[model samples]
Target: MTGWLGNRVITQIGILVHDIEQVSGAYAEFFGVDKPPIAETDSPDMAKTRYRGQETAARAKLAFFDMGPLQLELIQPDSEPSTWREYLDRHGEGPHHIAFVIEGMEEKVMLLEGRGFPLQQRGEYEGGRYAYMDTLKDLKVIIELLENDKR
Candidate 1:
């Protein structure tokens, strides 16, 4: 399929929660798997995080579960101005975004921006980068783009 994104395959689903440990524990029980470790996001220097078009020190505690063809991500944001925090504040705990593993993340983001869905938040991890697009008003949910560095 073809769209604004470089890739069309959805690789993950993200959920926002107030207490990750509690929610992740429940998911672990339901899946009959060990609870994934909760980890903090990269610092602003390392991640180069941006929120609302400006540099910000926003981060979240995250846990991930690989559920067959898709990964389930649970997020508990700090008191920072991150996308996670913003969504949780306005919408409460629930599905936050669906993610696509993509290539040419910057180019894809540019294309989306040209179409009016501007980038809301972005950050870099160890081997990949992620961007949250402001698509909720149009798509009913935010779209997250994940681009792994080519090895």
Candidate 2:
């Protein structure tokens, strides 16, 4: 996998929260760290995502905070039935999924899907695209593919 995806794994962490501000504040209070700057973005092209043969909005408020070598992302969805909203609604506030920074995310998703790894959800943010691959049969965890942010 490393050979195929040249970039080193920069971050791997599960982001959990009911509210983006609350979660980000908890990290700051617990780690005695200041919140990193945030960036706001909205693109109609990105909002029109194909999910289950239907177009859906992907509007969100995302902020990245530095925690040692790992970065914690706080995501607040602006649409119904979003991954974040689903997690919060179903499980309350908790670890959503572990993300793996990688290259060629689309290709990686295809390979994983072909290998019987069921994709629970997939979408794009301001920074990059990501997919949640169910690998419970092997490791009992969902693997996330986060492509590097080119913008």
Candidate with the greatest lDDT versus the true structure: 1
Residues 10-82 of candidate 1 have per-residue lDDT tens digits of 8999999999999999999999999999999988899999998889898889999999999999999999788
lDDT of 2 by residue, 2-90 (tens): 64335446476666465777767777778787865544436547644444334556456667876678767776665555556666676
Query: lDDT of each structure?
Result: 0.93, 0.65
Spell out the clash pairs found in candidate 1. Answer: none
lDDT of 1: 0.93
CA lDDT of 60 in candidate 1? 88
Q: C-alpha displacement of 103 in model 2, angstroms? A: 2.1
TM-score winner among the candidates? 1
